[model samples]
Target chain A: MPTLYIDLMSQPSRACYILCKKHGLPVDVQMIRLDKGEHKKPAYLQINPLGKVPFLVDGDLRLPESAAIMAYLCDKYSLPDNWHPGSSSSSGQAAAHQQQQEQQRRAVYESAVHWQHLNIRAGCMRLVFHTVIGPRVFKVPAVPQVAADGLKVLQQALKDMESYWLGGGSRPFLTGQQVSTPDLLCVCDLEQLRMMVAEPSQPQLEQLLAPHPIVRQWMAAVRAAVGPALYDEAHGKLAAAVARLAAAAAAKPAARL
Target chain B: MPTLYIDLMSQPSRACYILCKKHGLPVDVQMIRLDKGEHKKPAYLQINPLGKVPFLVDGDLRLPESAAIMAYLCDKYSLPDNWHPGSSSSSGQAAAHQQQQEQQRRAVYESAVHWQHLNIRAGCMRLVFHTVIGPRVFKVPAVPQVAADGLKVLQQALKDMESYWLGGGSRPFLTGQQVSTPDLLCVCDLEQLRMMVAEPSQPQLEQLLAPHPIVRQWMAAVRAAVGPALYDEAHGKLAAAVARLAAAAAAKPAARL
Candidate 1:
């Protein structure tokens, strides 16, 4: 059985957890509570020298980085075809199943994966690194402008995503007719970006994810593919846990929030 | 022929130019002349909404990111055999590439690509963006500290590169015995870093590319396998450039020392 070291509050970690559990991959869920600095512990640090969570340990082999890990596992397990249909990439052009075959092919989907790599992921990560992790690790205040810039990039990324995913793309998913590894990646990111703007701009995202028919269709397809219960469960894991803790805090007003 | 908009100073653009000309890919170089603000012209902006340089136009298919452009070309023209050597991935122990026969299957390469996508690439880019490009584009002062921090990450990345490139793996190359797409990607990056990083601090780098026995041996192997003259010319395009520019600058009394 592979062991997955996870900190659920971290979105990518949650992404791995959701998929692994959904696919029923043989994975041992070892909790590395990032907020509590458990990942920095000597024991955990020995596993992942970099001290990041959501790393996978199988036997003597240890793997880090979400995209690599996701790809590694998917290619390994032969999970359901929709996740990443092997034959699709083999001879692809347009979306499969009329599935807007063009949408599914080497252009829009592939470009989106590469595009978000630099723009969205980097931008979102900068926000978390500067505002959240840097302060926690280095006692430095998040440079206000840096965080602002990160959000601005996020907004533009959303615009690009909306353009491709809804505006032009025919597939219900970001890539096309079916979900690929990118969807797994985006689920984690978008959940973290509940607020598209500096504040909780869920309204803006709601429109992008729902009202935008393509995205709305894609979301439904993704939810259906991933399973609605699992999707909601994965999305709400942190929220539910946070709400629970908050309730406990309210029950005892003197307790910490 | 595809039209490529590029700025000479841009690293990715430089890489694209080198790959195209070196491989003899049919490409029409549309010099964006970034130094003169041609990239920001409305004509170029219509092609790439970002108004960023290094946009590629193949018929109506417009791609902005370098990764996207590279993938497009690689897919379009069936590239050389060694370019994207199939790697054993995702599949666990059941994965059936014979270890001995599986010449290109690599172990550490997965994390290498992962790190490139996440930490190394993003870190260096942020450093470049915030420190170098920020000042160049926005009239801000170059922040040495930011570059230094980025350099630290780059240094570690190079350290990892040295370990893996030197280490015998599935392929003698970065991914394996075969020089895959990442090898090209990595070589370009390493070459660019030679120009960017200070000389004294890059002692290991100098040694690796120089008289150092084992390291130089590995570098030679990379150049030889990747095609020495082509590699040299690809890199030399920039080196001769620096030397000539250096001589010209030295001749100018008004130039800052």
Candidate 2:
């Protein structure tokens, strides 16, 4: 059995968790508490020099980066053809043509993952941190300019997601009819924004998500695809943490007086 | 044969060129001149809305992102087993174990490619643009603070590449003894910094490269792996462009007088 070291609060970690559960891969889930700073400690650093979350240890192999982990799992388990159709078990020109289409789909997914890293992932994470998490959880004051900048970039990404990727027609997901890993990675990031907006301290974040109907529809579809039980299980820690932070923020005025 | 829309000045474009030529894949290289803004034009924009270089068109499929392009080429051509050993033609536990090791190697390579995008690629591109390209080509004066910050980040990336990834001892390439696609991508970016340092105007850039002997050694190995004639063919345009820029920079003072 493989060991997966993860903290559910991290988007990539959550994605990896869902991917494993979705496929029914037998593995030990070792929770590395981020709040306890376990990930930054020397023990964790020894395993991964970068000391980042969602690393997989299978036999002698220690792998980090959610994209890499997901790709490896998809190959190792030989999961459904839809996940990575390029490696489909077929032959001849028909197979070659199918492989070409699959490669194109894979390329689009790869491009989205890379683009998400610099844009949506970075933008939404920063916005959530500056608006809600930094102030409420960490007790650090929010930087308005930085937060505003994050919101701006997030808005642009959402618009692009809706108009460019999703608006192409009746596609249920980012790539096509089938849900892929990039969809998993993307929806996780969007969930961060959704979580922050759910907090009572930041009603403004809701307005940021209000305009994009396509985003809402796609996110709902992702939720449905993941199923309610696993979705809740993956996000349970994060939801609870946000609730606790919101409650504390609400009680702060009474304590001050 | 597939048509590759590229500009040699772009690092990823050069990587794609080298990968195809190195593997002996049939490709029609259609050079898109960035200086003339060919990529931004309506015709190219219709093909790739993102308007980025190093995109591939094979029949109806339009693939972007160099990493994906390289992976697709590797799969479509079935160049070598080592290039993507995870997708080997075998089965059962023994094959699964071998696949596991191959996937681990692939994961490391994937992680490196993603890490390279944000760190080395972004940092070095910004550093060279601010310190060299912006001032020389665009007639925009260099921002000392921005250039300094870029140099700082790039130096840190170089140190990490040397000590963390390459320092494991006596490896001919990044992932292993054999040079992979990620190696091609990484070497191209380092070559950009190398090109800038070669310019008489930017002697300071040389200092950034001087401290890392491991980087130098790895780069040499990558060059050797690609072979001289093919390597020279791939880099010919970029070299000429750099030379032209250097000559133009040298002649500017005389013109002003």
**Residue-wise lDDT of candidate 1 within B60-111, one digit each (tens)?**
5777766556655655655654553221122224346453122223224444
- Fnat of every candidate, listed in order: 0.29, 0.44
* Model 2 TM-score on a 0 to 1 scale: 0.83
In model 1, what is the error at residue B67, expressed in angstroms? 3.5
The total of clashing pairs for model 2 equals 0
Score candidate 1 by lDDT: 0.59
What tens digits encode model 2's per-residue C-alpha lDDT throughout A194-228? 55643555535457668887778888888888887
Q: Specify the highest-DockQ model's number.
A: 2
Measured on C-alpha atoms, candidate 2 has an lDDT of 0.74
TM-score of each: 0.73, 0.83
* Candidate No. with top TM-score: 2
